[model samples]
Target: MLSTVRRLGVRGPAVVAIFLIGLFAIGCSGAALQGVGAPGATAAPGVATGDAARGPVEGDQNGSGNQPPAAPADPLIIKTGALSLQVTGLDAAVTAATQKVDGLGGYVSGSDRSGDGENASASITFRIPAARWDEALAALRGLADKVLTERSSTEDVTGQVVDLGARIKNLEATERALQAIMDRATEIKDVLSVQAELTKVRGQIEEMTAEKGHLVEQAAMSTLTVTFSLKPNPVRTEQQGFDPAAEAEQASASLVSVLQGVATAGIWFGIVWLPILLFFGIVAGVVLVVSRRFRRAGPGDDTPPVAPEAGSAA
Candidate 1:
C-alpha cells in the first residue's frame, strides 16, 4: 500500500482523492451490512407499510403507556331523561318520583324546590339504567298530575363504535411501529425521535379512548327529569242555611214567575194583545167620529130633544 501511494503521489493529488473515496465507500458498505445506514432502518415501518410488528404491538396499543394496558374494552355510555308535570303537593310528588326512579336502578343527578311560602313546586334530574328507560318513562307518566312536558333523545354510536374500533386498530398499529423503532434504535437521536412519536401516538390513543368511554357510558344508561306542581283538591261546599218558609216562598215565586213569563210571551206572540189592540183601535175611531159630530152640532145639538116631546103628544 505504501509503495502504491509512493508511485501515485510523490504527491499525486488524484491518487489522494481516489483513496479517500474508496475508504468512504467501504465504510458505507459496512454500515449498510450492519443495517445502520439503510434508510429502511429509520423510516417508520408503520408509515411505510403499517406492519403489525412495526405498528401496533401488544401493550402500548391504547396509548396509556409502556405498561401493557388493559385490552381495549367497550366505550363508555351516557343516559338522560327529562320530564315536566303539573301536580299537587309538589314535595310529596318529588319524593315519590325520586323513589320510583331509584327503585328502577336509577339515581337523582339534581333536585330543586322553591316558591313563595304560600305556593311551591319541585324539579329533579334522575339517571336510570338504559335497560329500564322505557319503564322509567312509563313510571313517570303514571305519577304525573298533569303531564306538562316530556322528552328524550338518543345517539346511536353503533357506527361510531365500529369506527372507533378501526381507529383503535390504527393507533395500535402506530404504537407498535413506534415500539419497534424504539427497540431497534441504536442511535440516541433515533431513540429520542421514536419516543417523541410514541408520546404523540399515546396522546391520540388516550383521547379516542376517553371519547369512546363516554359514548359507551351513554349507551349503557339513560337520564330522567321530573317536575311537579301543587294544587288544592276540588271541594264541594254544603249549604248551612235551610229555611222551609224560604223554600215555600221560592216555589211560589217560581210559579208566579213562570205564569208571568207565559203571559208575556203570549202577548208577544199576539195571543193576548190582539183583542186589546183591536179594542183600542175601535175606540179611537169612535171617539174620532163623535168628536167630529159634536164639533158640527155646536149649539144645535141640544135641540134634538124636541122630537121626543112631539112623539108623546101623538
Candidate 2:
C-alpha cells in the first residue's frame, strides 16, 4: 500500500479520502435499510412491546391494528299473533285472559265487549314480553272451550336496526363536523349555511332515532290480539213439541198487530178523509140543485111559448 501511494504521488491522498467518504456513506445507507427491514428496530420510543409485537385482530373496529375483539349483536325480531276463541262464557274467558297476561309480565292494551249473555263477545289486545309469548298464548288458549282461529307472525329487523345505527353514527359525525365548521365560521352567510345543513341532519337523526326506538320496543315486546265469543247453542236434532200457551201468545200478538193497523186506518179516515169527503159532497149537492133549477126555468119555457107564432096559426 505504501508503494502504491508513492507511485500515485499527489492524487493518492485525495483519492484515499474520497474512497473513505464513499465507504462511510455506503455503510450508513446499508445500516439504515437493515434497521427499517427488521421488525422491532424502528419502533418508536415508549411503545409497549406487546402492542408492537401484536398483529391486527379478526374483528378490530374499523380495521385499526391491534384493537380488541367486538362483542356480537343480538338479533331483533317483531312478533305478533291473533287468536279467536269460543268459550262457554265470554266474561269468564276475558277475565281469565287478563289474569294470564298479568301473570306473564304483560298487560291488556285494549279491551272491548259487546252484547250480553250467550250472545256476548269480547276483543282483547295484549302486550307480552317476547320471552313469554308462547306461554301466554298457551295459557290464553286454555281459557277457551274451543279455539276458532289462530294466527301468528314474526319479522326480523336486525338488518334494519343495524342500518339505522350506521346511518345515525354517520349523521352524528357529520353533525360534529358541521358544528365545528360553524364554530370557526366568521361570516353570517357561512354560519347560516352550516346551521341549515346541521339542522337538516339533526332532524333526520331524530326521526331515525325514534323509529329505531319503536323497532326496539316492538322487538322486546310482542303484540297479541284475542277475540272471545260465546259458544253457539247446539241445534236441536228433534222437532220441538207444540206448546198451546206459546202458540196462543203468538196468535194474540198477531191479533193485536192487526187491531192496531185497523185503528190507525180508522183514525186517518175520521180525522183526514172524512172532512175532505164531506166538503166535496156538499159542493156536489149545491151544483146539482143549481143545474135542476136552471133546466126547469129555461128561457123559452119561462116566456109561455111566445104565443105560438100568431101569423102561422091563421
Candidate 3:
C-alpha cells in the first residue's frame, strides 16, 4: 500500500504532462498527415487498400472525389489609424463623427472633451468594422476644416491566430483526455491529483480561448483615433509665397531689438562703472586746481610782471 501511494504521487504529474504532450503532437500530426496522404489518396498502390480500409469514401456532393470548397480566408490584419483634424466647431464635429460611426455599424470606444467654445477640443477613439474603415475615414475627413495629421498602420497576425487556434484545440483535447482519466481513476488520491490537473488545464484553455477571441475581434475591427478642435489651423505660407511687407516688418523688428540691446547695455554700464568714473574725475580736477595755485604762490613772490625795453631806463 505504501509503495503504491508513493508511486502515484511521483507519477501523477508525469502522466498528465505526457498525456498533454501527446495530445498536442496528435493535433499537429493530423494536419501534416492530411497533406502527405492527399497525393497518395488516389495513387494506384494505396488506392485499393485505402478505400477498402476507409470503406465508402466520402466524396463531394456530385460524387466527384474533389475536395469541398475551402473556408473563407481570414484577413488576420489588425488595422489602426490616427487623425488630427481642425474643425470649425468641436461639438459639431464630434456629433457628425458619432453619426458616421453609428451609420457604419461601428461604435465609439472612448472619448474625451476639453476646453470650451473656440478653445474646445475633443479626442475620440473608434472601433470601426474592417469593411467600412475606408468609408469612415473619408466621412471623418469631411467633418474637418483641415486635416492636421493622418497616419495608419496594419499588423499581420495570421501566424499568431493560427498558432493560438492550434494551441486551444490541443488544450481542449488534453482536457477531454484528462476528464476520461479522472472518470477511470478509482483511488481517492489519484482522483484528487487528476482533478487538480484538470482544473489547471481548464484554466489554460480558458485563457487561450480568450486570447483567440481578442485576436479575432481585432482582426475584424479596425481602430481609429481622432482629435477634433475648434481652433483653425494656421495657413501655410510657403517661402515661395513670400510677402515684401512681412519681410519689412521682420527687418523692423530686428532693428528695434538691436537698439533695445544697446540701450540695455548702456544702462548696465552706468550701473556698474559710473561711481568709479565720478571718483576719477573729481581727483583729476582737484590736482589741476592745486597745481595752478602752487605756480602762482611760489613763482610770483609778490612781484609783478617783468618788463622788457629797448634800452635801460635811468
Best by TM-score: 3
For residues 26-83, write the lDDT of model 1, one tens digit per residue: 2322121222222334322222232222232356455332111232354344556577
Clashing pairs in 2: none
Local distance difference test, each candidate: 0.60, 0.68, 0.69
Model 3 regions lying over 4 Å from their true place: 1-72, 231-314
Backbone clashes counted, model 2: 0
Sorted on TM-score, highest at the top, how do the candidates line up?
Answer: 3, 2, 1
**Which structure among the candidates has the greatest lDDT?**
3
Candidate 3, residues 99-159, lDDT tens digits: the string is 9999999999999888876688899999999999999999999998899999999998766
Error of 2 at 226 (Å): 0.3
TM-score of each: 0.50, 0.55, 0.58
Ranking by lDDT: 3, 2, 1
Q: Give per-residue CA lDDT, model 2, range 12-122, as digits (tens).
A: 443343233223322322122222222334322211232233222223344232121121167788999999999997777788889889999999889888998777888
